[model samples]
Target chain A: MSATATIYLLTAAAVFGIGVYGLLQARQILRQLLAINLMGGATFLLLITLGGGADGPPDPVPQAMVLTGIVIAVSATAFALALLVKLQDATGSSDLDPPDAE
Target chain B: MIALAMDAIIAIGLVWLALRTVRGANVFSAIIMFIVFGLIMSLAWARLHAPDLALAEAAIGAGITGALLLVTWRRLQVLEGSVPQVGAETRSLWLTLPTGLAAALLIAGLGWVALSLPAEPATAGELAWQRLPEMGVSNPVTGVLLGFRAYDTLLEMGVLLAAWLGAQVVASEHRPGALPGPAHEEVPLVGALLSLVVPISLLVAVYLLQAGGSAPGGAFQGGAVLAAGGVLLCLTGRLEAADQASLIERVVLILGLAVFSGVGLVMLPLGEPMLAMPGVWAIYLIETALLLSIALTLVLLFAAAPGLRRRL
Candidate 1:
């Protein structure tokens, strides 16, 4: 791997680690969503960086896959936000854990 | 040297923003941080020579997703009179330490693997690059998305449609005007703004659609840009929710999925592989419908409405 790829690969791993930390610590659904997106971004970065480096003909396959992935992430986020709003509407709370669990 | 510096800056920025997004106790600020993180990520994409991804990340990843997050935040605020949050400020030291240890170890292993990958290994990318000319598109990325891996694109459209359907089903009510759109449709200066922005976005979206055949633009990016216009109209109260979808709205929402699958099935009878582009022209045709479908779907999702009506 080239220097650029090396930089991104390490960066991706670090970012993924941060995402994991966030996911474990978050109880709010929205924060959890943000954490998950961070992980997703890291994964995409790793995929593209591994596919090719800064120079030469960039790989199209991984680029296309990441494009598809970006769209998928948005759609999933939309649905999740809808669920969050509806949960708040029905129960006046957006917490994931049950009320009795406390 | 300069390129490396830029990359380093972007990498540090992404990690920092992600850190802020997750660690901040305030939800609003955290969401804003995440949006900014997306913007920087787009720059990183451009640095990587994936201009198409840069556009997609800017429009879809940052633009649409931020709007969704902010809108949901508004809804929660209205319902609860304040935001609701649950969870410990941080996991206990015992749990956190172990989590940290595990993450570092895993990442170290992954980093080693990534560093060890052969620099110039033969792969499908080389094959795709070779046959790109036959795919009837000049842009290899678009060619792959529109031709070589069309089945994936088809399934992604299906996923978008399914997600919208699921949201509609689970939504508690179809309350029209429930969103935080302005109370009055005729807010001053808003009309002038729309006249300017709407047309520009329209031009840009179509230009992007046309450019996808040879450049970095595509149906997804164009559609997301187009959706921004509709979102503007809805936010200003120009578009209101309706109890039932109008004929045009219904057709527009399904246009992409229908056109894509229709072409695929039609080709089956002719003994062509499914979703094979008949020619260059078919790619453009499918992209236009997809542009419309994706635009309408995103706007509908943003509005959180069953249907939409233009308020005159």
Candidate 2:
């Protein structure tokens, strides 16, 4: 059981690292959005793993919080996507850099 | 042994999907990969002993978020094609890899220590368990969200509302009546598909809400499910986006907040805590209202329009 938790945590950490690397390299706004979401998922995983219990059932508090975080993530993402669409329409470029760069 | 293997497989798959999401050759594939990553994360939540989290992740994280991403991807396609540039800028190994490695090390150390710690001698979780019966909810997670910590839940709803408002503020003055790419009419068999999916999703949303009082479901989960149904309608052209928010849309958007604030105000004279649920009945009543308002808000947000109308 303890070992299972460790594997989960490590997996989450690796995902977080990959998301961060992607965020760094992402030249497109859409890819960066996906990376940010991946990072959020990793953080949720980290919270749940950290709140694990060895014997009794897992903590309900963290579970509830993570649940809230998931919904909030989607809401934020939806708004962000809307912003992306509006931005693309305004500038004709999905990349956020200045128009002069083109 | 089997458990370990299952864990290993799922974990590796999740990381792989995350990597692919970042590295996918095109924006469309990257969005697809991100959706898969969300689904895998949902399964991981279940394995971590969090069915509530799993349900929310699958419904909201993977399902609704996927819809939003795909919609954005389609919108992006309209832009005149720009040649892809692979690496305009590169960071030194000293700059990038080390921060990632350090984050991993810190997380690993924290997990090991967390596992080794004997136990919380007296934790809020223990207290929550002991008080669960008093909350009159079978699901401890639900109880915490809507009963004991109702304040936080209320504020979360506010955050969602605020996000919608912020989006509206940033919206262009001449909001596009309908998105440019093929109006919903051009899709093949979309009507029949939506007729089936929309109702079923709504039913599931209601069930999730009702069951939430006693199980691994709640307003947020139910609302997301409902939003999914709306997404299907929008995709199929059964529902059209509107420039001006309808009167009814505005009412439903504020229903949850209104009901919540009303309850708190009504109870204030009695000298109870603001927003303190008077009893189990009040809890259910508020949850129902919250569920409805949340569902409507999510659907409205997804439509990216003020109102929706049945297809002509």
Candidate 3:
């Protein structure tokens, strides 16, 4: 891999790890949504970096897929946020764990 | 040397922002950091020579997503009557440690596999490039999206529509309104800003749609740009959430998928494969429809409303 590509790939790995940690550790539903998006971003970076080589044009297939993925991620996030709003309205808390359970 | 240095800075920034977004003490701060991360990722995409992805990341990833997150955060605060402090919750170390370790292992494995791949393994990009002429689009990404992989694009539109419908279902009782911006709409220069920005955004969106045939723009990018205009209008209180979708709004919402599939399916009886657009005119037609649908869907999603209306 080229030096630039190699550096980005490593960054993706680290970002992915952070996303996993956040997903596991976040208490609030909104925070978890942010983490999920972070993971999606990392995955896109990984896919693009992998499709890249040392020389010519980068792969268009992964590019197309990533574009689609970005759109899909936004859609899912919006729906999740809508759900979060409804949950807060119904239950009076944004945290997944009930107040009594904590 | 400077290019490498720039790459290093962006990569480090991305990691740092990702870390802060996940681990920040406050939810609002984390959301801000996430938006910054998205902008930096767009820079990285530009450096990687994918301008199409860069534009999409900027508009959709950072612009729309950030707006959505901030809006939701505000709503949550209003619901609770105060800002919520999102502190780290205590968890069993045993479970946390193992999960973190496993995630680390997965990352390491992915990195190894990515780096170890053959330098020039045949990829769909190569094939797409070779067959670009058949698709009648100069941009390979556009060609692949509308030509070879039309099915994915088709399903993607379906996904967007479904998401909007789902949001409506969840918030059935609460009718969302214009986002809270300046308390007074009569603030000096607000009109000037709207006039300048909204028209320019519309112009840029149409230009992008036309340019997608030969450049780094497309239906998705153009649509997002157009949606940004609608979003700006909403933020400024020029547009208000309506109790029901206007007839035109409903038509535009389904225009993309309907036209795309309608045209493609019509081809099947003509002895061509499904979704095989007949010519350049057909491509433009589909992209225009797609652009309208995408823009309307995104704006609706951000508004969290079934429809929009002009604010009196």
Give the range where candidate 3 chain B is weakest over 10 consecutive residues by summed lDDT.
B174-183
Clashing pairs in 2: none
Worst 10 residues of 1 chain B by lDDT: B82-91
State the lDDT of candidate 2 residue by residue for B63-99, as single tens digits: 8888778866766665434634334333346665775
What local lDDT does model 1 show for residue B23?
Answer: 82
**DockQ of every model listed?**
0.69, 0.54, 0.66
Docking quality category of candidate 3 according to DockQ thresholds: medium
Candidate 3 C-alpha lDDT tens digits along B87-122 = 345345786688778877877877777667676664
Full-model lDDT for every candidate: 0.87, 0.77, 0.88
Tens-digit lDDT string for candidate 2 (A1-102) = 477877887777778777877787676888899999988898888778777732257888877787778768877887887788778767766774544664
Output the better candidate (2/3) by DockQ: 3
Question: Which candidate comes out best when scored by lDDT?
Answer: 3
> What TM-score against the true fold does each predicted structure earn?
0.94, 0.89, 0.94
TM-score of chain A of 3: 0.94
Clashes per model (N, Cα, C within 3 A): 0, 0, 0
RMSD of each: 2.2, 3.0, 2.2
In candidate 1, list every pair of residues with a backbone clash.
Answer: none
* Candidate 3 residue pairs in clash (backbone atoms < 3 Å): none
